[model samples]
Target: MGLLDGRTAIITGAASGNGAAIARLLAAEGASVALLDIDGGGAANQAAAISDDTGAPVFGARCDVTHAADVEAAVFQTLETFGRIDVLVNNAGILLDTPLPGLDMTAWERTLAVNLTGPLRFIDTVAPAMIAQGEGGAIINITSIGGSLGFASYAAYCASKAGLMGVTRAAALALAPHRIRVNAVAPGIIHTEMTRGLYADPAALAEITAKIPLGYVGEAVEVAKTVLYLACDLSSYVTGTELTVDAGYVAQ
Candidate 1:
């Protein structure tokens, strides 16, 4: 049997990149997945591909994580389709990289909305149902090393991820009694479309690699595996923690 057999999972921003990887992996492990993203077209395509590959039921829905209505609707749709929610992975985020001096308030707000408040909104929408199920659930937030380590030109992204960490801890504590586990994954220099622009600059890529003991970028599946572990029964006793999948970048 697969690790997530008979479970239902909701993955935000699952159209592509790390989120899509996680969705595909979870489905492979026997979970019914609902792919949520603002990009409905991409999400639908991803869902179709996963269904074809895994022969598992996968659904897709458009969601703007920052909006309560969107989040609520998405959660409701998942429940309507799957009957119950066993896991929630908040993986939707955008980098609004800007130094403090040149930072735009609008960009900052957008970053916080998607990176921080979006997860909060999803939790708010899903927590009660999870509690009602009385079987507990898992909430995995996709944070970043930037949340803990300061980086140049990433003020807003860093701040939002840090805030997400805070949310993870607080929610973990509050939901423990109900058996709902909340945790976070802080990825370092994962090769994704989000980071493609940065990798375009050789200097930036070199600078990022220099900090990692692995001396190379990580892959989406590596991060997805960590997320899968956290979401599965393998982590039944784990909660309120940040799992850093940065290839020893934070060690230095």
Candidate 2:
């Protein structure tokens, strides 16, 4: 038996990269996964592929986490199909590489809307059902090491993630009474399509690799495994914590 057997999970930004990886892992462990993304076609294709490969119930929907209507529709559709949501992975995020001086209000607002407020809306919508179900649930927020560390050009992205950490803590406490757990996963230097441009530069890649104590770049699956732990009973006693998957980058 798998850890997440019989669970239903909602993963945002699951069309590709870490979100896709997490969805696949969760489904493999017997969770029915709903992949939501702004790229509707990509999400649908991914769901079809996973369902075909694993013979598991996987669904996909077009969702812009920044929009309340989209989130509501997606959640409604997911509940209609899967019955209940047992796990919610808020993995949808954007990186705006604007320095403080060059930052525009629009970009900052958009980043927060997608990265911070988006997760809140989802929790607000789904938490009631999770509470009503009385089986409890897990919520994993995909944060970044940048949230804890100061980066020169990642002001907005870092701020949003840091704010998400705060949300995770507050939500954890608020939901604890109902047995719902909230946590954050902080990743560092994972090689995904979103970071393809940086890894394409050999010098930049080498510089990043050197900083990692593991002497190698991380993979999407590595982060997925961490999410799996938090999604399942393996982390039953863990909540309101930030698990860093950064190869000890934050240690130094």
Candidate 3:
């Protein structure tokens, strides 16, 4: 039996990258999943692919986590189909590179909306459903090492993620009484479409890789596995924690 068998999950920003990877892994472990993304078509297609691969019940729909109506609709659909919501993965995020000399104000605002507040919007929606279930659940937010490491030219992204850390802690305490657990996954230098551009220049990629004690870039699956631990009983006693999957980058 898999760790998450008979459970249900809602994963945001699941059309591609880390979100998609996490969805696939959880479904493979026997959890039903609702994949939500701004790219509705892509999310639907990915749900089809994961369902085919795992034979797990999966749904996909358009959801802009920044919008309350979208989050509510998606959760309603997931509950209607799956009967209960057991895990919520807040993985939908955006990173716009606006340098200090002439930082784009629009980018700053948009980044906060998507990366920071978006997760909060989801938590406020999903937490109620989870509490109603009476069995409690898990909420995992995808933070970044940048939230602590402070990458140049990505101040808004960093600040938003750091803000999420605060959200995770506060939510964890508030939800603990109900057996619902809240946690954050902080990833470092993962090579995905969202982060591929950061490594496009060979010299820059090389420099970043050298800093990693592992001497290699990370993968989406690696982060997914960390998420799995938090999503299932393996982490039954864990909550209000920021687990770093950063190849020891923060250690230095």
Q: Cα lDDT of model 1 overall?
A: 0.95
TM-score of 2: 0.98
lDDT, candidate 3, 222-244, per-residue tens? 99999999999999999999999
Q: Please give the clash total of every predicted structure, in order.
A: 0, 0, 0
Q: TM-score of predicted model 3? A: 0.98
Candidate 1 residue-wise lDDT, 158-210, digit = tens: 99999999999999999999999999999998999999986899999898788
Global fold similarity of model 1 (TM-score): 0.97
Off by over 4 Å in 1: none
TM-score, each model? 0.97, 0.98, 0.98
Which model is ahead, 2 or 3, in terms of TM-score? 2
Q: What is the C-alpha lDDT profile of model 2 across 1-252, one tens digit per residue?
A: 888889999999999999999999999999999999999999999999999988889998899998999999998998999899999999999998768786788888999999999999999999998999999999999999989999998899999999999999999999999999999999998989878987779999988889999888899999999999999999999999999999999999
RMSD of each: 1.0, 0.7, 1.0
